[model samples]
Target: MRKRLQTKLSATLPPEQLKKIYNSFDIVGDIAIIKTATPNLENAETAANQIMVIHKNVKTVFAQSSPIKGDFRVRQLNLLAGENKTITLYKENGCQFRVDVEKCYFSPRLSHERARIADLVESGEVVVNMFAGVGCFSVIIAKKVSQTKVYSIDVNPTAFEYMQQNVKVNRVYGNVVPLLGDAKEVIQTKLQGIADRVLMPLPEKALEYLPYAIMALKPEGGWIHFYDFQHATREENPVEKTKTQVAQKLACIGTDYRFASSRVVRSTGPNWWQTVLDIQVSGKPSKF
Candidate 1:
């Protein structure tokens, strides 16, 4: 679909500028999010219109004006084509999520990651999703894994509201619990020492909140799925740097843990990798 849009856009855009257009776009529900750089932004709407013409399912096209930032992790968007609305129903892994793209941060890119984490969930295990946006990971796990419980925590009230609705829409009310507030605060106050597996999916703040995740695990030990973004040059290893950084943080707090595995989940940009560390925390649990 993107190629078709790009081909149609080539008539107006220069060949040098053609490479500036991103090849892939996010299709959430009926909305298509296409990002255009400043150089090629003049033709952004044209591309969006072409996308709408090429793809029958896409009803709304939004141009991402800025990077995802702030406490809510939402980006600024401009309607380039079709409807002006941003609220939409997204489906993934048989679970439904109602989200306002402008208010809540939802990524279709994490679909595989969500399913991967769900597949790792053992029956009867208690999982705590520290950054469950719209309860995507939590809901997917609850619907896919029977006898498992997930405590979905999010700081954004709007995201939390949608998360509650998503739980009902997907009918995973018995398995997924939605909590509002900061992950650390929520975990410390109500979810301490109850999780069998802790998911820190928010790469931006996962390391900062690692202690909370560690404290949320049972003293006997459990799993911590840690996510982070790292920059690596030609000589440095991004994943190793992440592990070392995580180890240093644990050491600072006098905590001991073992790394089960580390994987490069995806490449965010040139020489930048999004990594996940599967860590096993043992021995005495730390006090918040």
Candidate 2:
């Protein structure tokens, strides 16, 4: 889809500026979010206009002007063309989500990962998603499994608000509980020892809050869907490297864990890949 946009844009933008549109744009519902760092703002505006021309469904276009920074994980978006609004309705995996593109962190890229985790969930399972941004993972799990319960927690108030709306929008209702606060405090106060599965989808806090993720699990053991960013060379396998790193941490925390699956979710940059590890951790440890 992006390459088609590039070809469509060839007549309007120069080749050098075109390469800056390198990463392509993300079409979330009627919004087209340009995901690359263009050296010149004008080039991005031109590209955004060209994108709208190619994808008629897109109603808004914005260039990601900054990295996904701070606690909320939201990037600065420069409005390039189309509508000025940031809120849009996005659909995926037979579910609908209302997202505020600037205020919340919503990745269309993680759609596959969300579906993968939902497929692994069983009916009546208790799941706690420690970093459920807009309740993507949790809502999908709830929608997929009729009898499952999901506790979707996020520190960002806006994300949490959107999560609540998304739960209702998808009609998960009693299945998904949207909680607003830090994962550690939420797990410490209310969610400990009650989960059949836990998710650590936010890497910024994943390592620091890992113990809390484990604490949310049932005493016997449960699954941990851990996500992180790792750098690897051409010859190095990013998945194995991530497993080794996760293992070293688990060893110190004193948990017996077996990696059920590992994969490179996406390429964040050259040689830098976002990775995920499906680890089954057993036994509880005092170490935080």
Candidate 3:
């Protein structure tokens, strides 16, 4: 179905425009997924304007500028919010995350999503964000989940430094540990015991980490937040595809698990969906 939709879209949209739209909405897991509409790519400004119309929830838009010698370089712009206020986001509710667009890799969508997740985390629980981008998830969780200990891991040094700063600024350094390295390597060598909740937000490649996520589960039970995208058929449900992926990965490691709950966290585009599957390992559920 996704392929069919893509074929139809390809006929109507310019190749460059189609590519841009695809890349724009190809939301990386661990980041926020925002809904976007098809844009008329004939005019660059018009296409951008169309995006602005449907994406009312987002106060910022990253626009593509001309490249070197008139090529295109994507640029971020602050959007207008209602009457007198320009959309400005501050580290709210003890969240110490700040994005240095000049030096740091940042995503407005991810930042907003982290804030939302932070609001949902409970105290005294252990949370691990596998792809902790700049500690956005880690800091927010630490700030909100006072009793919870968060281990945020990332392979990028620049991102790790910013994450450390965020933890300190939020005054949750005691609760959040900024680990600098790949999650695959760190999880095996450094982390022990099962986590109350594990966040696998790297949608593009999250399936590959399912085994590790299951292995890190807290014996009796724990929740794994799995995010990814898959092709769906008319008879196929996106949620079910995600479940199958999880199950297959677990089987690869000879582990069994059950879905506690599942829901579409957000939709990115036509046929392309971002779903989160909350799973509990087989057996009695543990009290976290």
lDDT of each: 0.87, 0.88, 0.61
Q: Please give each candidate's TM-score.
A: 0.95, 0.96, 0.67
Task: Tell me the spans in candidate 1 whose CA falls farther than 4 Å from its real position.
Answer: 285-288
Collision pairs in model 1: none
Candidate 3 backbone clash number: 7
Model 3 stretches with alpha carbons more than 4 Å out: 1-96, 101-105, 110-120, 233-235, 282-288
Error of 1 at 86 (Å): 0.6
Give the per-residue lDDT digits (tens) of candidate 3, residues 160-215: 77778778777887788889877877888877455878888778668877666655
The number of the candidate with the highest TM-score is 2
lDDT of 1 by residue, 1-288 (tens): 667767787897777656556454688999989755463556776677777888898899998888889989998888888989999998889888899999999889888888898998999999999999899999999998899999999999999999999999999997999999999899889998898999999999988998899889987879999999999998998999999999989987777789988998887767999999999888654544
Error of 2 at 237 (Å): 2.4
In candidate 2, the residue pairs with backbone N, CA or C atoms under 3 Å apart (3 or more residues apart, or in different chains) clash, namely none
Q: Report each candidate's C-alpha RMSD, comma-separated, in the order given.
A: 1.7, 1.5, 9.1
Deviation in Å, model 3, residue 249 alpha carbon: 1.9
